[model samples]
Target: MNQHRKPRAQSAFTQRAVRVGLFAAGAAGIAGAVPAQAATGLPQHSAIAVDQTFSRADFVHHTQARDSFTVRQFGTVNAATARNQANAVGVGCSVDDHCRSVALSFQIVTMAGEHTHLNAINRGDAVNEHCDGCQTLAGAYQFVVSTPRPFTLDKGSQQKLADIHRRLDALTRSTLPATDLKTRADALAAEVNKVLADAVAKAPKGAERPTVTLHRHLDGWPAH
Candidate 1:
């Protein structure tokens, strides 16, 4: 009877150890699914450094808190067919390491001389829509051209942009609102898209449509 009881106790201990090992393995897998920054012992909130350039105009936008960020670009236009370029940069951290990436977007908004005709060129990747570790970032570009003209946006694009703008505008005016970084970033994206869509809609129709292009040098950034 003693020998039998001792064997039973040994078997129970072994089973308990196996169960513990399985639980640890499961916990590790869950951690692996999370962002590296969160897995590593890093502060939940830290200052994020941001910089942006639009059509050769340079600006810096940063936030000490990880809640939100905004960037605005404004410049003067003097040429008949002017080209615009913009890029936004930010740094993201993992558990023990950090990497820098940039978001790039561009569009051409112009008006013909002596004519009320407006023209714009829209490229697909006109904005950065994805940043792995970035909670939220917002940006805008407003150029003080010689004279601005009215432009029409595609029905689909126009409606989408308008919706986004309206939502953002409402949020901006709210006295007290509750939301997260992802929501704010999404609202900001709508504002940017509306600007571009409006430019495309108002773009003058002619055989000599100017060319618009976007050149990006960063990885893991999505086009809008």
Candidate 2:
């Protein structure tokens, strides 16, 4: 009877050891899965840019005229495209109790990365009042431009959409202003409109084009 009890005790001990080994193996598999889960949840980065500009002008008397132009850009734009995106030219004159100021601001953003350079020129003398066929009297203007990276949307593309929204908000709130502010905002708007129209025309069928919205404010200029 004692020999029978010894064999039974040995059998029970072996069974308990096997159960413990199986539990440890299962916990190890779960630990390995944690990294794979984290990798799936990581956000994928994409390149995008949103550029906007605003211009203001004010004049007092024939001799004292002031013009200001402000340009702001957000997001990561390609260096080459941004370098040559916009060109602005202006001319003004003050002569014989007559003074005038004119400014033009232009900018473009394309699928191709491009740089935008702000150009401003002031010419006119009170004494000579020589008008070199220059025009004056321009008003404030505003422009909005966007360039989205190409992508294909799948059924489960919610994560991609969220990423785009995040980038848009970042660009909208944080704008880089140019050193000089003398470009006509309206002229810039017209240029951006043309760019958007061209983009719409060139888009592929079934492709989702970027959305644009305009916001105007009577409040003073925005802080840099």
Candidate 3:
């Protein structure tokens, strides 16, 4: 009985040794067979760049490089254009024969301005949360333009309505005075800066693409 037990013990030991050796060999083979491209610092897809200011003066996309980057920018061009329509409205309203025409310009401008301004703010908000032109996170504005524009306010025919309209109309106009357009512009610039955050991706980190840059140049506005 003792001899039979000894042989069984030796057989079990031999089996354990074979299993350990096989496991070691498999691990070594896997380690040695790793893709050489990954081992030598090469990425799968190339890199592209998109650089531009408020309006894209020049935008270029790049690929394959030692120190390469893809820069994306955002600007409120369409909303701004819609907001600027106020100037045409102002001129048209002033010339129209109807009394309500001229008065309506203020409302139109204010409402449009409010809408446009809101849109800009919304875009910025999207960037902060989503890190892109459109909202990436749960709560974000895809795009918005809220400008303050008043409605038709002509008093001679409708005295009560006109009086009430005047008081409420003030709300539609920008609180910023004529002396402060520049200040307001500065504020907008700052807000824009806040929205446009820089995205840095090393060789393997930034393929997801933080943001996409686009452009629409205004006719009169200076190129940002």
Model 2, stretches more than 4 Å misplaced?
A: 1-96, 110-142, 150-195, 204-208, 212-224
Best by lDDT: 1
Enumerate residue pairs that collide in model 1.
118-204, 119-203, 119-204, 151-202, 152-201, 152-202, 153-201
**Local distance difference test scores for all models:** 0.26, 0.25, 0.17
Every model's TM-score: 0.25, 0.25, 0.19
Candidate 1, residues 1-224: lDDT per residue as tens digits? Answer: 10000010100111112101101010000111111111111212211112232211111232111111222111112222212222233333332332222222222232222222212211111122222332222222222111222233346655664565456545533332113422464446545544554554455554333222221121122221
Q: Largest TM-score belongs to which candidate?
A: 2
lDDT of 3: 0.17
Stretches > 4 Å off in candidate 1: 1-108, 113-157, 162-224
Candidate 2 lDDT over residue span 28-113, tens digit each: 00111011111111232222222222222223332222333222333323321111111111223323333333322122222211
Residue 27, model 2: Cα distance from true site in angstroms: 60
Model 3 TM-score?
Answer: 0.19
Q: How far does residue 195 in candidate 3 sit from its true spot (Å)?
A: 3.4
